[model samples]
Every structure is written in structure tokens, then in C-alpha cells.
Target chain A: MPLKLFELVGRDAARPFSPYCWRTRMALAHKGLSADTIPWRFTEKSVLVPYGSERVPVMLDGDRAVVDSWAIANHLEDAYPDRQSLFGGAGGRAMARFINSWGDIAILGGISPLVLADIPKLLDQVDADYFRTSREARFGKPLEEVMATRDQAVIGFRRSLEPLRQTLKAQPFIGGDAPDYADYIVFGGFQWARVVSPFKLLEETDSVYAWRERLLDAFDGLARKSPGFPV
Target chain B: MPLKLFELVGRDAARPFSPYCWRTRMALAHKGLSADTIPWRFTEKSVLVPYGSERVPVMLDGDRAVVDSWAIANHLEDAYPDRQSLFGGAGGRAMARFINSWGDIAILGGISPLVLADIPKLLDQVDADYFRTSREARFGKPLEEVMATRDQAVIGFRRSLEPLRQTLKAQPFIGGDAPDYADYIVFGGFQWARVVSPFKLLEETDSVYAWRERLLDAFDGLARKSPGFPV
Candidate 1:
């Protein structure tokens, strides 16, 4: 069965990396699962609500609908057991799950404020009225409040980054010698910051950048060069 | 092999039904794993920092140090096969994982503002200096500014709740008739709110309340009772 994936086109200014989408894509590649990506526009998510939320990175295996990145990653892993394993072994499974969650809360939470700093510029490129109205709808706050929230969020991000950067320095990837699901999720967040931010914050960490280089080098050039957004 | 766990008493909040902590506890109940619950005092997450960030609901199984609620829950389901399966069967694992992530981002994020509303009352009950300092550390702004972030978090949560609550109305739990990891994660967040908030937000939904009651009833009086603070 062909795995059909639905994802966003540009990195969402509100949520840039979308570790969830990255995890699914990584799993699809690792599992050797034949999956097609459907590029979705954020404004057009209403069309896909039948599957779940207007969230991108929804996967369809035959008739079964799998939304959320963690679930999709697992389904692909189980569905195609012959491919390279994301979890590696039974012992590694727990570690993988823990790292995935850590990436979501710790890494993504840390990186979000930094990503949002450029949102005003991105909003100018898109629809201004829609951006203002839609953001308030989603966040229930005016632009001024959201901006203040972003500043606070960035402070929180900086605090989290210290320990995380230290950890990255200790190992080649989160899973030690090789890259795995954990690495991919964290990499997605870092990649989002790298590609979207004008300042390029990821370059500060040589170890992290080295890991990103390895991941980019490992993938097919076409997939690597594809105009993909971090769903 | 002995299953291991790391618990920080009132790690997230002091409420009897802290949803974040409950995910780990409920999973332990499901897998029948008896591990130590090290009661954590305020400002003493030094125990967690060496292993990872000072995050709650940590699980150290053998050599692996698993952190975060979703990660620990998934680890338990994957590591323990025979005891009541959190995934149910092969087909259900993906759905279970999705529900887990959905709860983390959508469900938990939705209800977070409401949950945090009680922080002031909770602060009085906790170590005053530590509580205030910790708030400053995580939110990086005054309590008011930190409080504002909830507006967005809650909006996203409410958007996800209708469909989720409807799904629960049709069934006893998120994963259909029986309880699964997803149900527990959902239960944890709401339970935290129910325990802390003066407002009875969960009472509005029968199925959601009933589901909590089921878990409360299953764990007997033991689950319903709070583990009091060390005053």
C-alpha cells in the first residue's frame, strides 16, 4: 500500500520546524515505504479536516488515516519492518520515544521564539489581514500580546538551549554514534531555524551543524533539494 | 529484569490528578511495572539534570534514561509486551501513538491555560522563593506575561476538543472501548485541571468525566486521593 502523506508548503511562521512532520518523513524514508507527499497550504487546511485537524503531515495507508507525527512514524516502522529501523532494537525503543518527546517539548519549545522573530517579515510576504485575523483566531490574542509572548518564549528558549547544546557536544547524534528518529526530530527544529531565520542561529553549534550536514548528505539529492516545508 | 522509573512528587503541580505525572503512573499500572517514586522537593531537580533536563516523569529502564511523559508512556508500551497492551494490537499502535502526540500538542495545549490559572494558589502552597524563581526561569517574564501565553495555548486546545470529546462520547475512551496510552495522556492533562482549578471545566463533557471516573474507580480510592505536599 502506498503511504500518502499530507504536509504544508512553507514553514508555518507560528510553528516552524514541525518536528512531528519531520519525524514522519524520516520514518517513511527509513522504512523504505512508498509514500507520496501532498504539499498543503496553511490557508487550505480546511479541505483536510475530514481526516482530523487542519494539520499537515497526515499519512494515509490504504484507507487507514494516521494523523500526528509520532503515530505516522510508528506505523511506517511497523508496516515495513524490512527497512532500516528507526528504533534500532528493543532497548533503543524506549530511548527513541523519550528523545522524540524531549525534542517536541524541549527542543521545539526552545526554538519557537527564535523562529517567530522573523514572523513579521514573513507575514508581510503573505496576506496581512489574514495573518492578523487567523493568528488571533488560533492564539486568541492580539498581535501585541503575541509579540510579548514571543519575547518571553525566546527567553525560555535560551534557557533550554544551554543544556541541549551541551548534550549535542557530547555525542555525534542524540542516539550516539548514528542518527535515528531523535536526531531527525531535533534536526528538523534546527533546520527550520537555519533556513528561515535571517541570522542563522544553528551555525553557532559546530557539532549540531556537522550532524545536519551528515543527514543532508545521506538523503537522495532530489529529496534533499526538494522545496519542502517543515510541515 | 526490574523495570525502573523516576518520579518527582508534584513535579508539574500539586493537584491529585496532575495529568502529566498521571501518564507515567497509569502506564505503570497498565504494564504492572513497580518502580520507585522519588518524591522531588522544590528546587531539587538536580536528580534529573545529570541525566537530562530537569523534567518530570522520568523513567530509567536499565541503562536508558527516558524523559518526558509521552516518551515514557511509549517506552512502557513497547518494553512490556504481555501485561495489558497500551497499543491493543498491531493495527492500533499507530493510532495510539497519534493520540498520544495529539494529546501532547492539541489536547494538552488546549487545556494548558486553564490548568495554569491555579499557579498563584499553588505557589502559596509550594516553596515560595523556589516557585517564584522557577516561574521566572521557565517563562522569562513576570507572572502576568507568562500567564498571557496560555491564551494561545488554550485556543488551540479548544479547537481540538470538540471532535475529540465527540469521539469519546461515542466510546468509553480515546482508543475505542478500552483504555490505551492515548486515553491516559488525555486523562492526565484534564485530570490536572480537574484537580487544581476551581472551575469544573471537565464536568461539561460527560464522556470525558466518565472516562476519568473509570480510571479513578479502577485505581480504587488510592488513585482519587492526593499525595499531599510536605508542609
Candidate 2:
């Protein structure tokens, strides 16, 4: 049987928006593997309970279930070693973990405030309520209020990406000449922003903007074909 | 002849303290290769003129001259394929470049202000004058003035290390189970700071501190044996 992946979505099942899920999606595409997507939503924890996860990007490859995007990427790499390697070698795999941490802390965390307020608008009432209540508790304010200073906050976000920007200036992708798991790790956050929010996270002249354009066009435009804004 | 490396020092030749040179030092040790250190001081630019570069860590591997820490690493990896790998593989080699950039910008840059004032004290009168004039010009302020707010500024430096700190919490080293070039890349900055300053860059409780401790003990205390303050 083909692999099946639980991907986070909202009111529109066609739009899979979770940053972690996009990482797995791109990883699968990179390996030339296809997974049937099971659209998940914010309030759908019960759906993943049997899979031993309360998160999206949980993959079912036959009877074995892999939870978390990072785990799923590892599972895919180990299970299909004959396919193109996700990490070039042991070294790449280890360093990619650093990249993954940077992706979570720097890229995803940086983009969250800019896009948080726009997320609930695309969710169903129940999911929207769940998102707002949970997120507000985390931020100690309403989502919109958290995002009120996003215009000014984005300058810091851009500055936080200096390492990434500098790297991309010297190479075509984070993985160097070819897109690898490292590139997918960061691009997942950008793709998530594009899917849900129209906010301008990057200027067109930025090298990062150009790198994203290349990844968007990668794998026969697999990411582009997925529903997302022009960002 | 055995390999030779020109490493930056201040007054005491025993305390070679350029962050880039430390990176090459650790990389050589990782590859089980040793180079005789040619101590280069701040005012000794003429010594490197024949090497086609004005930088320390210009490695002389027999008849060949390899310049830059990154280039020296690549040279070692390529020249001694029979030895242990500096980068795990091609994928790792590519990703290490990103880590290298992060080390320079985040680790070295962040630590500069916190330890800048202490650096000149480690140098001789001639080198100290040159160092202060050059660094002050770069900062557009006196070295002491640039570091005046470092007591409070260190907070931001610690916060900037969140990604590296987070990675160390999950793994023993940035290179994962063992130290690799990626580990050396960031550790070079920490080692540089430790070599010149008594400033407390990492709290005793920080995971990064533990990671540094392990590295300090790596290669049979190669870095620790070198003259440095007890950071």
C-alpha cells in the first residue's frame, strides 16, 4: 500500500498549511514517493490519537506509524535507502538537525507572529475558536494584538535571517547546489506563510526571495501547485 | 616536511587565538593530521605575503599553500581521504558551509562585544596599539566603549545562541554523537573567547557550556592545554 500522511488543513481541505507537514510533503516529493494526504484540522486531535501523535505530518507506511515531520523524514530515508538520499551522509544528517533547529527557532518562530492573526480567518468556526483560545493563552494576548506590531516586528525577523541570507547569497540552496532536507526544513515555514497569509515576509530583491522562488518551482512546481498566496 | 599552519597570536606565541585558526586546528585534529604552528601576530602581515593571502590559518601542506580555515578543511579532507573524514560526506560538506556562516555571524559576532576589551590586554604594546586602532575604527568607538554595555549586552548574546543551545540539549554535539567540522566551526569562537578573556560568556548551567567542556577535553585536551583563561 502507498504511504498515507495526516496533514494539517483548515476549512479548505485542499490547503495543507502546517510548516512541519510541508517539510514532510517536500521530503516525499524529493524522494519521488507519493503519499495520500488525509486533511487534518486544529480541533482534530482525536483523529491522530490512534497514530500515537496529536500532531499533523504523522505518516502511516503500512502498519508502522511515524509521528513528527523529522521522524517521518528519517523513516523515509532509512526505509528507502536506494532512493536519492535525504541527507547526503551521516555528517549531513547531523548538521541538518542544526538546520532543523534553526528552522524551528528562527524561521518558523520569526514567521509566526507575522502570520498568526491571519490563520484563524481560514479555519472553521470550531477550529478557529480552538486556535484563538490556545494561541492567546500562549501569547497572553489575543492573536490580533500579538500581531499588531508585525509591521515593525518584521524588521527583526529579516535580521534574524542574516545567516540564511548570507548562505543563500553564496549558494543556490541551503543544501548547496541542490535542494536537500536542509532547504526543505526552512522552506516549510515560508510555504506555510504563503499558504495562509498574504503578508510580505520578504522583499523581491532579497536573495532569500529568489531562493524561495526556485524551491517553489522545484519538483514540477509541487509546492506551487498546492494552494497558497502569491507570496 | 610536516604540514605547517600560520595561526594568529598576540604576545604569547603559545596562545594562538584566532577563531578561524582554531577551526582549522580542530579540523586537523579531527582528521588525525597535525601541523606545526607558525605563530603570526597582528602586525605581521608581511609574513603571509608569499602565501597569496593576508590571513592566519594559511596551511602549508608540503609544497601546496591552502588559505582560509574553510579551504584548509577542504584541503585536509581531499588530501587525506584515507584518514577520518572532516565532513561525513558531500552532503555534510555542503551543510557545514551554512554552519560556518552561522558560526561567524552568530557565535563570533555575538561574542565580540562581550570580549572585545579583554583582547588587547593579551597583546604586546605594538599589536595592542594596532588591534585597538583597527577594531575601534571598525566599531567607530573605543574598544572599551564598545564593550561598556556588555554586562547587560551579554543577555542578547546568550539569547542569540538559543539555536546552538537547543541543539546541544538534544544531542551531545552539533556534529551529533561526535565532534565534526560543524562542531569545530562554532567551538572555534568559544575557544577564541576562552583563550583571551575571563568574561563569562556561558553560564555554568548552560548546555552549551557542557558541550564546550566535552570539546575542551577532545583530542586529549589539545585546546585546553593551550594557554587560555579558565572560562
Clashing pairs in 2: none
lDDT of 2 by residue, A119-188 (tens): 9999999999999999999999999999999999999999988888888877898888999999999999
Runs in model 1 with CA error above 4 Å? Answer: A10-19, A117-131, A137-156, A203-206, A220-231, B1-231
Q: Model 2: what TM-score?
A: 0.99
Docking class for model 2 is: high
C-alpha lDDT of residue B139 in model 1 = 57
Candidate 1 clashing pairs, residues 3+ apart or interchain: A6-A57, B19-B188, B110-B157
The 10-residue segment of model 1 chain A with minimum total lDDT is: A222-231
- Model 1's TM-score against the true structure: 0.47
Model 1 interface CAPRI class = incorrect
Work out how many backbone clashes candidate 1 has.
Answer: 3
